[model samples]
Target chain A: MKGTFRASMAWLHTGLGLVTGWVLFAIALSGSLSVFREGISVWMRPELPTVPVQTVDATAHAVAWLTDHAAKSSAWYLAVPNHRAPYVFGTWERPDGSYIQKALNPLTGSPDGIRDTLGGEFFYRFHFELQLPYPYGRLIAAIAALALVVGLISGLIIHRRIFADFFTFRPNKGQRSWLDAHNLLGVLAFPFHLMISFTGAVTLVTMLLPWGPQAVYKQDVMAGYTDLDPALESRAASGKPGHLTAITPLLQNAEERFRGAGISQVYIYNPSDAASLVTVIAGNNGTVSTLSHSLTFDGTTGRLIREHVETRPAVRTYTFLYGLHIARFTPDVTRWLYFISGLMLTAVIGSGMRLWTVKRLRLPHHLGHVLTDRLNVGVLGGTSLAFASYFLANRLLPPMSPHRAGHEVQCVFIVWGLALVFALIRPARRAWPEMLAACALACFAIAAVSSPWTNPVTQSTALVSLLFSGAFGYAAFRALNGKAKQT
Target chain B: MESAGTLRRPLATAGKSLSLKRWDLACRILAALPGGYALAAFSGICLAVWLPGLRVERAMTGMLTGLLIWPVAFMASFAVPDGRKMLGGTVIALLALMGLAALRGWRP
Candidate 1:
């Protein structure tokens, strides 16, 4: 009976992992990249200066720019410049219901010469949204996260010699090597994998199971949100036009009130009206909770209106989990640790899927075996190549091209689709090494095309790309040699 | 004649048991997936309605804690060898939770 139970758990682990492994891989990989989302945004736009700027100066620049260009906008949102992101990120809602987003210069407050692109925001969105519309993508991603949770639990149960196997790695043994690698990666970063999956699922829990809120709020979702993170009472815009007060003092007041937590976001409502209000949000620099104290001020007079801080324990707990997953509060060193662990998690998923195929290849070549093997190469290899192409697209596309951001995103999907087709047409043995080689070439190209070696951010980004290039090149060589041995 | 009859009985029972096992597995899957989710949702509803706190806080706590039920329910569904018992137990627990929620003024 005990043996049967273990066998059943093994079955569950394998089946669940196989079903959700690809989507989880994509999510994990993109999530890993998103750890450096701000840096990647900076890298994508080489036109932006990397010199650090003061928060007040950046906010002033953004406010001035919005007042000049987006005066008619209902509201303007500004993300102040920080250590990671060097420029002010601003977005405003126009009267026509359109939204414009730009990275404003800290010195000049202009978007001059900056190309239009989603930058790192693309990967961040794709991490959770999966490029699908509205709730569908989020729903799918959430379900995949839940599946990952189940997979991890079952995998733990099935890995009987977990500690014993951690120190064992027999290389060049084909299937056994793949299993060992998968187990090693999974076991090495087990806590990170578990935390990430559980937190990832919890982040979207409301969407997955809305019954709790539904039962309590009964169609009043906004009320529940108000309770979770209370905001100042919103007022309608008075039609009378008024001149806006300077924002620098108001931000200083908020910073003082927050006790030097620094200001992260500023929201200006009814910018040209008498009822204009400015809301300054505290940055998540020092706290594990994303819930921060916010201060609202009268936009016309720059007088304090109200201060809001989350005090509810339950709400604080929820935000802490959410913030842990977002990792915005981490310092530079901790952020790198997050990034490395994220990559390790991705590697675990990839190797686990590869183990499934490698184990089956020794058996008679059934259709299922053939298809899984081909897809394993296509998805795992193709995504890496596609990610490399995204960077390549950013560098190669015309700076002034219309709809350039959309085109860059399209480049990713188009290359990924072509890689899939290439994998399908070619034999599995050839496809593996060929795709890895292409990935290496693309990474090398990205490093080669980067300019201005003086900037530390750009230099480090290029160095990372070169490192990836070397890794992929070595993998491609190994794959080619392994195929030669089989023949 | 008795020996021939015993042999025939074992053959028929073997054929019947194979189909029965397949049905059991199918039922177990159903219980694990959709039924497990239903159990989790109902548990969330119960917590939201019955827990003592501000309405929103109760709801948030319930939602957060309720999501954890899914994996446990999923594993539990397979841990039991009898599929019928597993499905029946899930249904009973879900109904009881819903009943408790109803008593606490929850609707829909």
Candidate 2:
């Protein structure tokens, strides 16, 4: 009975992992890159000056720019300059229901000379959205995350010698080697895998399992959200034009109220109306919880209207789990650890998928095995190549090109689709080494094109790309050597 | 004649058992996925309506609890080999939870 139970779990783990592994791999790899989302954004836009600017000064500059250019806009959202992202990022809603995003110069507050691109936001959004239309991508990602949680737990139950096999690796043994690598990666980062996958699902729980909230709130879903993350009540525009009060004093007031917590974001609603409101949100640099501590003031009079802070245990727990998954409050070392762990998780999924095909490849070759093998190479190797192409596109695309950001994202999918086609046409033995070599070349090209000496962010990004190039290059060499031996 | 009849009877039984096993496997898979998810959702609704807390807090706790319950429910669906018993038990629990939620004024 015990033996049968373990075998059943093994079956469950294999089937679940194989079915959901591709989407999980893509999500995990993008998520790993998104660890340095701001840094990548800064690196992609080399035109932006990286001079450190004070938050207050940056806020003032952003508000001044918005007041001049977007006075007729209904609302303006601004993110003050920080160490990681050294520019004032602003988005305003136009009366036509469209939105414009621009990075403002911290010093001059001008939206001049900055290239248009999603920057790091592409990876961050792709991590959850998979580039699919609204709600669908999020739904798919949430379900995949839950499937990962189930896979990890079942895997833990099936592996009998988990500790004994921790140090095991047998190279050049085909299926054995793949299994060993999968187990090693899975075991070494087991806790991180569990935490990340579980928390990832939790982050989207309200979406995936909305029945509870829906039942309670009936039709007022927005009320449920307002309760979970309390925000200041929005006021209607009076339609009469009023003088907008200065933002510096309002920021100072919020800072004092926060007791030294930095203000990260500010939102001005109805900036040109008599009933305007300015809300200041405290940064998460000091806390692991992503819950915002905000103060709203009258935009015209600059009088404090309300302060929103959450002390509820359930909400705090939810925010903490969400915060942990996003890693927004992580310091430098912790952030690196998150990145490395994310990569390890990706490797686990990649290797496990490879193991599935490896175990069956020795049997009579079937179409199922053939398709899985090709897709393993296509997705595992192709995604890395696609990500590199995204970076390459950032540099190669003309800065003034229309829809430049959209084109950069298009390069990623186009290259990825081409890689998949290439994988399908080529033999598995040859495809593995070739795709890996291409990925290595792309990484090397990214490193070569990027100027490493400009700033720490660029320097580190270049170094990381070079390191990835070396790693992929070595894997390609091993794969080629194995192919030669087989022949 | 008797020997031929015995041989044919065993072959027929073997074929029937094979089909039975396939049906059982399909039922279990269905139970694990959809049935387990339903159980989790019903449990969440129960908690949301019954838990003594603020509306938001109860709702959030309910959602988190449901997420935590899903994997366990998935495993439980497979732990028992008898597919009919496993699925039927899940359905019964879901119904009970739904009843409890309804009693607490949960509309959906």
Candidate 3:
């Protein structure tokens, strides 16, 4: 019975892991890249000048602009710029559901017209959304995450001696070497892998299982959310228009209230109306939880209206898990740790997929075996190549072209689609190295075009690109030399 | 050891028969998809109704725990070995949780 149980788990791990391996690889790799989304975004748009310091009252400037330009808006949001970000982002909702957003210069308060590219948002969204339509994309990502959790648990159960092979690595043994590397990466990052998947599922729980709130709140999710996180609220715009007060005072008041906590965002509800409200959300830089302490004030008079700090045990647990998954509260050093750990998990997934093909390559002529091998290269190598092309497109595309951002995304898919076609036509052994070589070239192209020596943001982008290029270049060299097949 | 090997050998041999393989695949799918999902949902509702906390908090806790429950249920779908046992165990656990949930909600 014990043998049978372990066998069943082993089968479950292999079967389900193979079925969803490609999507999991893509998700992990993209998520790893999105750790530096801000830096990547800054690199993509070089026209924006570097923000000197955090001296400007961006909240006041953004509010002043909205008072002049978007006075009729029912709701206004101001995203204060940090060290990495150069511009204050503003968004206002019309009477209808549509929203208008702009990037404003933190110093001058004028709109920054760098480019229309989606920038890093494309990779961030693709990490969880996969660019699919609406709820389906998110639902698929959640399901994939759930499958990963199942696979990991089953794997732990099957591998009886967890530490027996901890220090084992045998090169030139082909499938054995791949298996050893897979196990090594998996065991090394097991805790992170489990935590990431579990928290990822919990983060999407509201959407994945809407019934939980529906049954408890009698289908009134808004009421439930008010208790869960009450920082956000909307008020109708009064038809009677009025002048606004200076927002610097409100921001200063919020900082005082939170004991000098940095203000991350400012909100104006029904701005320029008699019944308007101003809300300032506390930053989570030093905090362990993702939920920001919020203070709402009367927009007209600048008097404190309401304050919410989530202290409930259940909500705190949720926020902690959310913070761990997103790592928004981590400092720069810890954030890089998270990024490297995320990349390690990506390597684990990729190596496991490779092991699948290497094991089946025993029967070389089998179509299923060939298909898996080609797919290993096509999906893994193709995605890496596509991401590099995305950066390349950002550099090459004309800045003023309409739908410039859309074309950048299209470039990613076009390159990826071509690689997939090439994978199908070429031998698996040949396809792997070829795609990897292309990935290496694209990485170099992005690094060269960005000219990373100028600014800190560009420097970070160049460093990451060069690192990937070196890794891919070495891997391509090994694959070309026929040494990639050894265990 | 011989008996255990014998028990496993027949399952491997059964795969050679397409019809048996198809039936086994169907059973596995049934146990994994609907069976596991129902168990998670019922257990969640049971905890949500009976657990000590505010209504939303209890629901959130129950739902998060329920998400964890799904992987166990999924693994059990295969761990049970026998297709009949897998389906039967899943239905029983799901129905039991549902009954507990109903009784908890009956106070109205």
TM-score of chain A of each: 0.96, 0.97, 0.93
lDDT of 2 by residue, A1-487 (tens): 7756666777778778888999999999999999999999888889887676888888898888888888999899998877888888888998798888778888878777888888898999999999998899999999899899989887887666678557767677676677768878889989999999999998889889998888789999778867865665587899999978999999888888887667778899999899999988888778877765878899999999888887899888998899899988899999999999999999999988887887777779999889989888899999999999999999999987888989999999999999999999888889999999999999999888887557788788889989999999999998888865532
Could you report the DockQ of all the candidates, in the order they appear?
0.26, 0.25, 0.30
Single out the weakest 10-residue window by summed lDDT for candidate 1 chain A. Answer: A225-234
Better of 2 and 3 by DockQ: 3
Candidate 3 or 1, higher lDDT: 1
Q: Which should have the higher TM-score, number 2 or number 3?
A: 2
Residue pairs clashing in model 3 are: A171-A487, A172-A487, A173-A487, A174-A486, A174-A487
- Supply the global lDDT for candidate 1: 0.84
- TM-score of each candidate? 0.94, 0.94, 0.91
lDDT for each residue of candidate 1 in A234-270, tens digit (9 for 90 to 100): 6789999987899888888888888867888889998
- Candidate order by lDDT, decreasing, is 2, 1, 3
Q: Judged by DockQ cut-offs, is candidate 1 incorrect, acceptable, medium or high?
A: acceptable
Q: In DockQ, how does model 3 score against the reference complex?
A: 0.30
